[model samples]
Target: MRLLAFGDSFVLGQGDPDRLGWIGRALAGRPEVTLYNLGVRAETSADIAARWRAEAKPRLVSHEPVRLVFSFGANDCSSDGGAPRLAAAQSLLHARAILSEAARTAPVLMVGPPPMPEPGAAARLEALNEHLKALCGRLQAPFIDVFRPLAADGLWARDAEAGDGGHPGAAGYQRMADLVAAHPAWRSFTGAPET
Candidate 1:
């Protein structure tokens, strides 16, 4: 399987102690899957939407199943003094366009934005997660809610706070990897259980 992980700094595993980030940790031992991490720091969904096809196209190969996993919106939810960096409506519109184009060729799984250590960010992230869920429903894509569960967890919260006020440490990234591992979408994508 060929997997493409695209998004922002969190997806890149910015503060992880192991330096592997969540994506690398999640797919570490799986030799059958080839993962391309295209996570950029400080990028909004608009940026990802703009570059997804061009970035993802050449990497795709024939005779192999391709899967795309996106984790974004943290930057979008960030406030510039008072206003969000990317408006909620624009975020969804970009998502609609990106997912519409990607799903036509490969299966897509969306991992909603993780919680940041900033004040009032959790609620905003939750709202964005809900919006993503609805969008995923309409698009027939699988959505993973990483925020809801991690919002209340001590490990993720503490690690995120202790790190850089944004990215989490090794323990938190491991937890994220665990969540993705347990998800049915992971199972469906890998097909290891069936084999």
Candidate 2:
């Protein structure tokens, strides 16, 4: 099996050890699977959508029975500034459309953006994640909520997050990987026998 991960620095495991990122750590010891990171720093949902066909599709081609993991939204909030909610919604809808198209060729997993540092931004992040979750449900794709688990008590802001308060360090990435691996979707993806 092969996993194609696309997103921003988070997927790249930015501040984490060896830059292994969460994807690298998550698939570790799973020799049966080959994982590829197509992450670009500071990429937004819209940006990912724009480049999906050109950048990500080629990787997906060789990885038959592809599992596309999408980690986005953080950059969108950072870039949107004070944009109106309706505008953001429209942009998200467009991004989802692109993802829908991609899903036709492979299974898709939508990972909600990780938590941010700014206190005021939580609401926006929540809104965006909610939209993403709904879109994933509509597409019959799996959705992973990374925000809530890392939001409270400076979970993503801890030292384990590498002092950036944004990207996660090794421990933080491990936390993320653990949560993701335990998620129902993950079991489905791996086709592991029920526990």
Candidate 3:
């Protein structure tokens, strides 16, 4: 099976102690699976949408049982002096377009943005997640809310507070991996029997 993981630094496993971000960690020990980490640092939904097709098409061609995972919106919620880097509406539009197109080609899963230590960033991320969840519903795509649960998670919150205020450490990513592991959508997409 082939997996395409795309998004920002979080998807890249920024601050991960093992350097295998959550994606790598989750797929570890499964040598039969091939994973491409196309995550870029400081990328937003717009950046991902802009580059997704060109980057994913070649890899997906003739690749049987291909699946895609997108983790983004943190950077979109980021602010440059009181102004969001990307407006919520624009982010939603980008996500809708991206998810709709990707789902047509392959199984798609979306990991919503995580919480940031910046003041009020959590609320913004939550709002973004809600919108994304609704959009995914309409598009018949799977959505994972990494924001809400992580915001309430002490380990995740502490790790984020300690490191860069955005990306978390190994524990945080593991928590994320754990969440994905338990998700029915992930199981169904991978054809892995429920745990």
State how far residue 164 of model 3 sits from its true place (Å).
2.5
TM-score of 2: 0.87
In the range 1-195, model 3's lDDT, one tens digit per residue, is 899999999889999988888788777666777899999999999999999999998898673779999989888988876978888999999998899899888889997887787766667878888999999988888887767777776778788778877678898988887777677877677666545
TM-score of each: 0.95, 0.87, 0.94
* C-alpha lDDT of residue 193 in model 3: 52
Is candidate 2 or 3 superior in lDDT? Answer: 3
**Alpha carbon deviation, residue 123, candidate 1 (Å):** 2.1
Minimum summed lDDT over a 10-residue window in model 3 is located at 186-195
Name the candidate that leads on lDDT: 1
Q: Candidate 3 — which residues are off by over 4 angstroms?
A: none
User: What number of backbone clashes does candidate 1 have, counting pairs of residues 3 or more apart or in separate chains?
Assistant: 0
lDDT per residue, candidate 2, 71-92, as tens digits? 8887776634565334457657
Global lDDT of each candidate? 0.85, 0.75, 0.85
lDDT of 3 at 181: 63
C-alpha lDDT (0 to 100) for residue 50 of candidate 3: 95
